[model samples]
Target: MKRFVLLVLLVALGGGGYYAYRQQHSAGQEARASAVAQPRAVPVEVANVELMTVAEEVEALGTLAADEMVVIAPEIAGRVIELGFKEGESVKKGQELVKLDTAILSAELKQAQADLGLARDTHERLRSLVSRGSGTQVSLDEAIAKLASSEARVELAKAKLAQSTIVAPFNGVVGLRSVGVGDFVAVGKPLITLTNIDPIKIDFRVPEIFLSRLKVGQPVSMRVDAVPDRTFTGQTYAIDPVVDINGRAIRLRAAIPNADLTLKPGLFARLAITVDQRLNAIVIPEMAVVPDGMGKMVYVVDGGKAKRIPVELGKRLPGKVEVLSGLTPKMQIITAGQMRLRDGSAIAIKDKPLRTSQL
Candidate 1:
């Protein structure tokens, strides 16, 4: 009977321990379920919606061109006696640039002048005799005709003499000369090149769709591979009235001040034309934007939870973007830790909120 009592007590103790263990296990599972139901907040970085100045810009490729360029050539062929200009040097308008041998031209001019003088004397003598009724009217008429012809010859000779000397047509820089002193050149042969580049012009083409936005006097900025460290600024001066049929583009020209003469013609240029600008525009960092199926979305912190909001995008800046719609100022936008976020997911800010001015 004593042994039976001991066995029963031991069984009862084991049963109590098992019942307690079951209760504890059930409670632990319930705690785990509760924890899952209420997840911890996701940490993120946030910034306020920015209200700043923004510009609408269009980009294009172009080539630099001189304001005025011309090939310096002679109108009359002759032996080049003297060159009045040095290559790669600046010259003034009407300055002597080249002189051709004018020995034959000068002699012809002098003979023509002597003939004009003789004809003038004969015409005068015949006029006097006709007035006094001593010379026939026909003779006077012949003398008058001869005098006119002689005068015309003299004028032609003078013109030919002037053509032997070439003068600069405009203020510009002279390029390399193809012919030098003592070199015989033919008529219309290119002697050198003259370029006027103080106020340089750049020609670029833009798509026809941008025609309405483009106009004269719009500000433009440009960069070139040759001048990497500097950015040149100018304004649109001309737009082609007719669209290019082959390329469906409109040609544009801008004038840039190049007093220092740093920008050279034929250099490849990258152009940015500012068509529109706004002083008060809503902006946000680019990283805050998320791509949805066909649209874009961003997360905004509202009441310690992330609320995904769709946005209409505008022109993009360096690392920021303009918000055209669906967002207002002072909204906190998540810039980081967006991968784990869903609509209405709880968020814990990891740092101080950045203001628009700070951006």
Candidate 2:
């Protein structure tokens, strides 16, 4: 049919007279035919599917906490007499942190001691008189009762005097002082904050599905914005026995040693808990995979054509990803120039096919 058209045109134009026109027309038609017969091949690169060993990890939002935290408060109201510890100072357990005025307590203690001394003398005299038949039994019994009461008062007075001093309940770092000398503080008013941060606690939660894998000493690694570029590690110390009904999560606590005193309480934490690891797992370069709207997809060059394969992805590593399904070892994948390519589109590889290791 093409030959007939060319011959008819030659006859009308006269071969020699239209030689230049014939050449141009013939070239244009040839180009059009070539385009129709063969579409442009999209250039791409491919890699060999590989096997990788990777840890199956779960991530959770968490918080750092002081191992022990308490607000030091006074049990009885009094005028603050003296400060025993400096702000942000490390204090030993039972160290005095604050002291309240003791004038009233001191006077009461001395009076009680004097009364107790008198009671002892009277009781001794009464016993001697009774044994010698110089004292009535009723009189001796009354004196004995008075001595017991006086002794009880002395003990009570000592307890009140001790309350005038506030001692550290545990070894910790004392926070800011809330009251100063001469400040009248009420009972139960906070005097300062004390925290035991050595071997700090971390609290986080994970889905209930991981309950079976959780243990008392499972390892945990974490990062925090406050301590940038550093990873803190610890072992799981506690797990809530009951799962949260609303969220279906189990609360977990880990203890990380703060030997350097670097970690601070209440810092936000990102934790990665390694539940398990998989060996001999198929993996590929993360860039080879593309989004498929419904799930994920990757293109493989098979018989010089792009085959769009829907893939299921697994755990990921830096610059590489795990292909859980829909691919095989040594399958040529189109790593580049995939935007213009579709199913069965011809592909021209730009680089030599390399192994996933090269990724």
Candidate 3:
């Protein structure tokens, strides 16, 4: 009887332990199910889409040029006697630049003047004789012709003498000289280069499709690799009337004030012309945009969940972009932590929402 009681007690203890173990296991599984049903929110940064001023711009690559440029050459062959200005110096309009030997020309002018004086005396004598009826009409007419020829000769000599001195046609800077004193130069030989660059020009071409939007006096902004830190502003002053048949582009020219002479001709330039502008246009931070297949997308937080939105983009600005569609003002756009986000995924605000003013 003692042994039976011991065995029964042992079996009852084993059954109670097993029942407790099963109860604990069931409770643990229930806890795991509840945890799976609720997901942790993803932390993300957000910004508000707001209306702001946006510009419609056209961009093109161009080359810088001088407003006025010319190659200075002699009009007549002569030996250079004097150089009035130094190389690479500013010259005023009508300033004397070069002087040639005028000895031969001066002698010819003197001879022509003497001949003119003699001709005038002879003509007067013939006219007086004619008035007295002593000279024939044909003789008086020949004297008059001689007087006219003398006058023409004198004028020709003066013109030739004037050509010995070369003057600047306009206010500009002179380049290096190719001839020195006592060096003989033929007519039309390039002697120097003169350029007017205070108001520089930029030449660029745009596709024909933009012709309707282009106009004279449109504002243009330019940048160059030589002057990387500065941005130059100017206005469109000219457009080619004819389009380039091969490229289908129209050429444009802009004038930029270069009083400091920092910008030089022949430098490569990047240009942006503001063709149009719109106030109260939808704008957003560039970071909020995500590239989708053949399109662009962004995440906007609504009801504490991330909603993927497809957007059409317009002109791009500095660190910002214009949203033409699929977004509105005052919407919270996720700018950060988008890599782990999916449509309708729960999100937690990581920081204060950015406003348009903040951007």
On lDDT, the candidate that comes out on top is 1
The deviation in Å at residue 159 for candidate 2 is 1.6
lDDT (C-alpha) at residue 279 in model 3:
93
By TM-score, how accurate is candidate 2?
0.64
Question: After superposition, which runs of candidate 1 have C-alpha atoms over 4 Å from their true positions?
Answer: 1-49, 288-310, 327-359
> Which pairs clash (backbone N, Cα, C closer than 3 Å) in model 3?
none
Model 1 over residues 95-117: C-alpha lDDT tens digits? 99999999999999999999999
Model 1 TM-score, all chains together: 0.73
lDDT of 2 by residue, 1-359 (tens): 99999999879778666888889999999999999999988777877888878778789999889999899988877899899899988999999888999999889999999998998899899899999999989988988899999999999989988988999889899999878999999999988999999999999999998988888887789999988899988888888998999999999999998888899998999998878878888888888888999899999988999999999998888988988889988787777677778999988776665444433
lDDT for 35 (candidate 2): 97
Q: Rank the candidates by TM-score, best first.
A: 1, 3, 2
Q: Assess every candidate by TM-score.
A: 0.73, 0.64, 0.72
Per residue, candidate 3 scores C-alpha lDDT tens digits across 31-86 of: 99987987878888988997898878899999999899999998889999899999
Clashes of each: 0, 0, 0
Clashing pairs in 1: none
